[model samples]
Target: MSAATARATIQAYYDAFNAGNAAGMLDRVTEDIEHRVNEGAIRHGRALFAEFCSHMGVSYREELRDMVIFVSEDGTRGAAEFVVHGEYLQTDPGLPEARGQRYVLPAGAFFDLKGDRISRVTTFYNLNDWIAQVST
Candidate 1:
């Protein structure tokens, strides 16, 4: 894939997320996608990814804004930085209790592309900052 194509693929993934189309986002990934969550365990495959999306949907509502995407010359690696504007809709286990709290946080994700689909996704953010913001 060309660099432009890779950037488009990554951008489409975020667009899908912002549109609340989990399945559409998943469609852009490989079957054995490796997902490294922010301050959380690494998970593999599409099934687990789907479950994660479901859990997140129930616990929080989020959208990415101010996105900036980057792609390597080889088109095999990419990254994005964005701000997450979110609402804590319900309590997640082992986390602060939720009461529809709103928070904004800067976040980023690194991507490894195989052909056109994303094969690896590593996301990062300040978990403590999120806790502080929502805990108030």
Candidate 2:
């Protein structure tokens, strides 16, 4: 994969997310993709990823804005930074009670690419910031 292709793949993944198309996002990842959730455990395989997406879909409605993507010259690695504008739709376990609380968070993700698909995704965000925003 070229750098351009890596960037495009990352962009398409985000586009699918914004479109609420989980299948589209899934298409960009490998069958054994490793998903490192923000402040959570690492999940392996497409099936686990699908489950995570389903839970997130029920808990929050979110859009990533001002995204900037970067890819390595070798095209084996990539990263993206964005702002998440979201509304908490349901109460997630161990989180604050959700009453449609709105929050804006700065987040980023690092990716490991294999061929044309993403093999790993490790996401990062300020959990305290998110908690404070939803708590109020």
Candidate 3:
């Protein structure tokens, strides 16, 4: 894939996310997608990703803003930086209790392309910052 096409693919994934179209976002990834989360375990497979989305939907509502996407010259890698504007709706196990706390966090994600789809997604953010915001 060319760099332009790779960038477009990543943009489409984020667009899907911003639209709250989880299925559309999943379509942009491979069946055996590898997901690496900051301060969390690495997980694999589209099914797991879907499950994660469901859980997140119940716990929080978020949107990405000020997104900047970058693609490798060879079009096999990409990265995106964005701000997450979100509300904590429900508490997850081992996390602070939620009462509709709002937070703004800067986050980034790195991607690995396989063919035309994303094979790997690794994301990072400041967990302590999030905890602090929601705890207050």
Candidate 3: lDDT over CA atoms?
0.94
lDDT of 1: 0.95
Q: Is candidate 2 or candidate 3 better by lDDT?
A: 2
The sequence of per-residue lDDT tens digits that candidate 3 reaches over residues 1-136 is 8899899999999999888888889999999999999988888999999988788878998999999999999999999999999999999899999999999999999999988899999999999999999999
Where does the lowest 10-residue lDDT sum fall in candidate 1? 52-61
In TM-score terms, candidate 3 sits at 0.98
How many clashing pairs in candidate 3? 0
Q: How large an RMSD does model 3 have?
A: 0.7
TM-score of every model versus the real structure: 0.98, 0.99, 0.98
Ranking by TM-score: 2, 1, 3
Cα lDDT tens digits for candidate 2, 1-136: 9999999999999999998889999999999999998889999999999999999889999999999999999899999999999999999999999999999999999999999899999999999999999999
Candidate achieving the largest lDDT:
2
Cα distance off (Å), candidate 3, residue 72: 0.2
Clashes in each model (backbone N, CA, C under 3 Å)? 0, 0, 0
In model 1, residue pairs whose N, Cα or C atoms come closer than 3 Å (at least 3 residues apart or on different chains), thus clashing, are none
lDDT by residue (1-136, candidate 1, tens digit) is 8999899999999999999889989999999999999879998999999899888888989999999999999999999999999999999999999999999999999999998999999999999999999989
State which candidate, 1 or 3, has the greater lDDT: 1
Task: Flag regions of model 2 displaced more than 4 Å.
Answer: none
Clash-forming residue pairs, model 3: none
